[model samples]
Target: MNPTWNAIRSGLERGVIELRQTFTTAQDLWGYLFPAVVLLVVMTVMRDSEVPGTGFSLGAMALPSVLGMNVAYGGLVNIAQHLAVEREDGTLLRAKAVPGGMLGYLVGKIVGIAGAVLVSLVLVLVPGMFLFDGLALTGVGTWLGLLGVVALGLVATMPIGAALGSLFPNARSIGLLFLPIIGLIAISGIFYPVTSYPEWIQWIAQAFPIYWLGLGMRSALLPEALVAAEIGESWRHLETLAALGAWAVVGLAVAPIVLRRMARRESGSSVAARREKALQRVA
Candidate 1:
């Protein structure tokens, strides 16, 4: 067997093990469920409200958009946080010492994070189906479109996450990203129609994958009439694909260089210094 293939297989095993652990550990389980619960509560509060200019339930419309946002969050922030924490703790350095270990580590992360995202999707979706109305889940087209968007979203965001993780010095620095992410979500129309936002805000939202992912998911799950609420009264599938593809291209092109540089800089002394800082904080 090819060594790289063997490493990937090992990574797959590692990812599976980690995924199982997440279910078993109380902290991990809470991490997985907390977001879904909050989103569901928000949706419940909006269940009676109608989407602007439409009779459709606002909660129902927001459900898929929330799912799309979750995908973006998992592929980007979750992975970035994990990379930063692991690098500080010497996981990346350990991988650097072994042939193909970095490849294995990365593959493991992709698999694990993707699995977690899917689980979160199911958690929100199953409950959402019971609580919300007007979803178009029965059609084969809906499932296929959803699957495509998810795959594209993961490809588009995960490498950027890795690169961002590499750029950060520690887990604390990743918090700075949260403010921008919230701003993006606000402008991306996750809870409302983007068509109603200012033109400049609309343009800013369209430039990011979060907006496209939400748009794609809405295209999959909402009735055609809901397109009236979207920009141009269309799903804009081609634009969604183009924007996400551009991010994927740029992220994939840049991640390896950044990750390699980060790995090269890792050493026993650096990890120890980080550990000492953490201990001092705790003390």
Candidate 2:
């Protein structure tokens, strides 16, 4: 037990190292930076509109949601996609061979991804405060709620990410995997309002974690934005909390099963054969 715990710690430390290495890699930075630029451009184009009450500007209303979306994209989607590639390349197998390897590796990733999200929030907030005229962080309660939403959002999404990583085990397949999620985000009112969508589509969006995270953010940092909603007060908060909690529960339960199956299937020769086949197919 002690050895396993130590191994977990070591894997976590190694994961952090891996994440830092990724930042230094030119391709990784380029991939993330391009989308960030696009988001900034779009936000700049959309910042002139007025938010409901509280005199908050459109930038202020949109800031929290954008932050929520970025965290989801960067933390969950990015991590999962990268892990899939790594797993296919036997990176996970290598880690599993070390002491407390898998646990440590996962812990390190969770911490690293959380750090990445915090950095992203800061990058967005600093410019947001200056460029936008009406921005505020009213009270401690609101701030706490924001923290809660971020924390909960990570917990809910990470397991699903791990499950996806374990299930798809290759970069090409993983790229294909992200299309559905991206589409969901579009339909979930990230870039637009959910009300604009049909009832069934709204229901589908509500079933997913991203929408609930956005709703929780809209509830927390942008409380005034919630007033225009048709639902009653207690129900909305309860609904947001319930949906996120339920997804977290289900994802957490399923992640281990998927991971165990992946572990069982992993073999050095099989990985080599797959890589060779992929290369051949490409050629």
Candidate 3:
């Protein structure tokens, strides 16, 4: 077998193992379910309210948007967090020691994260379909568009996460990323429509992938009439594709170089030195 293919297969197996593990333990299951539960609670609270001028349930509108946020968030933050924690724990160094192990490691991470995200979508989407009344879940087009958006979102985000993870010295610093992500989510219209926001805020929001992810998802699941709540009163499918594609291109281009650099630096001594630094800081 070709060495690269073997590595990818190994990674896929590893990913499957990790994906299963997430659901087995109480803590792991809770960790995965906690955010979903919170979002559901929020949606429940908003269920009584209506979108401005539409009489559509505000909570219904938020369902797809929140799904989008979950996909993008998992792809970007989960991978980065894993990478950082793995690096600190010397798992990355172990991968570095094996031929094509880094490739396999990345493949595994993608698979594991993608599986988890898909499960999350199903968990949230299924319950939401019953709880909400306005979702457009009746067509093949709806399903296809959703699949496309999710695939694109993962491609656009995971590499960037890997690249960012390569830059961080430790997992603790990843908390800093949370604030900016929250800020973006606030402006990206996950909880509400972006069309009502000021144009400048709209422009800023549109510049990032999270907004497009939310928009793409809304385009997929929301009714055509609800387009009134969207900017330009259209789904702007082409723009969502273009914006997400740009991010994918950049992430794909940069992640390899950064990962390689990080791997090259991950000698035993370097890991020991980093561990020493952490211990000394704690002391």
Candidates' C-alpha lDDT: 0.93, 0.73, 0.92
What local lDDT does model 2 show for residue 261?
Answer: 87
Clashing pairs in 2: 7-99, 7-100, 8-100, 11-104, 11-105, 12-104
Off by over 4 Å in 2: 50-59, 223-226, 229-235
lDDT per residue as tens, model 2, 112-173: 77777776776776676666654446788878988898888888888888888777757777
* Cα distance off (Å), candidate 1, residue 131: 0.9
Backbone clashes for every candidate come to: 0, 6, 0
Count of clashes in candidate 3: 0
Candidate 3 RMSD computed on C-alpha atoms after optimal superposition onto the true structure: 1.0
lDDT tens per residue, model 3, 241-276? 999999999999999999989998898888888889
RMSD of 2: 2.6
lDDT of 1: 0.93
TM-score, model 2 to reference: 0.88
Best-fitting candidate, scored by lDDT: 1
Query: Candidate 2 — worst ten consecutive residues by lDDT sum?
Result: 226-235
